[model samples]
Target: MGKSERNITNWKQYNQALVNRGSVTFWLDEAAVNAWHCTKHHGGRGRGFQFSDTAIETALMLKGIFKLSLRATEGFINSLFQLMKIPLIAPDYSCISKRAKRRCCLNKRNLFRFP
Candidate 1:
């Protein structure tokens, strides 16, 4: 009503207040870095070598963001993410979802067979 920046005098502090990621050390472990590197390079083939650091972060962001549904979140990541800013190693939603589904610890498929 009064000024365009009214009530938001300390925007920097306010923005910083929302940045509660716990810690970066645990998230960026050596194993994670190695995995990123391997994924980026396509297991040393150098096919996806152009991948950047942001790509991995973006992918992870998507997993957490769309925790309930793999389809929606991955679609968003693929379409909205800036390819140039992220690494080429980043895979589409389908790829991630398929891997997740396969790895899921679901009930044994044949355990309940009635035959």
Candidate 2:
């Protein structure tokens, strides 16, 4: 039995391919941008939420997808925003954690469903 080996003939294309593998393309639609901030007031005693549910869900989704810690997730999102030149701010790690717990409760009650 013999094993076949492959060799790179063009270093330019190979290097380009490697660079492209690390590139990530992301964009936020206008509707998503509009829904990023909380508009409705809960009329609570303390301060109201700045970011909407959509934002929190987005952060949590990214966290799970990237397998990143809460703080790392926050930085990742903020960096994405910076790259996109968007003025939006990422939700704090603590806020994401709290919302994640709440979302778990809602899921247990079958109140939240993902499509």
Candidate 3:
């Protein structure tokens, strides 16, 4: 074997990291769900939302991380909540799409800001 291929570097650490990735303990905490409610306020009719901004952000993160479609992301989050036995409601795929669109539109306006 060539010198470059002769030795395995940090193979144990790499293996452990891979193992750790499968553990759901990281984002499955009750605090993660609770943080969503702390800032939620019902300002008026049609203004109150069932899911929190944090929940939406988390769903987006999961969608990108797992390469899921909007519908699939909804199902994925639902399953996670069920597994965790948390009494939280999951947002629908359409909700995700709407929020993502609004977020993109806002970001576009901010993209041209100089300061």
lDDT of each: 0.46, 0.82, 0.70
Model 1 quality (TM-score)? 0.32
Per-candidate clashes come to 3, 0, 0
- How would you order the candidates by lDDT, starting with the best? 2, 3, 1
Give one digit per residue, the lDDT tens place, for model 1 in 23-93: 32223334443555434344545345333444434454556644525566556554443533444234555
Once model 1 is optimally superposed onto the true structure by TM-score, how far is the C-alpha of residue 75 displaced, in angstroms? 3.4
Cα-based TM-score, every candidate = 0.32, 0.68, 0.63
Better of 2 and 3 by lDDT: 2
Supply the global lDDT for candidate 1. Answer: 0.46
* TM-score order of candidates, top first: 2, 3, 1
Best by TM-score: 2
> Which parts of model 1 have CA positions greater than 4 angstroms off?
1-34, 37-61, 79-84, 104-115
Native-structure RMSD, model 1: 12.0
Query: Distance (Å) between predicted and true CA of 90, model 2?
Result: 0.3
Write the residue-wise lDDT of candidate 3 on 3-87 in tens digits.
6755668999889999998985645666787875536665767766666666777777777766788899988888877887787
Per-residue lDDT value at 58 in model 2: 86
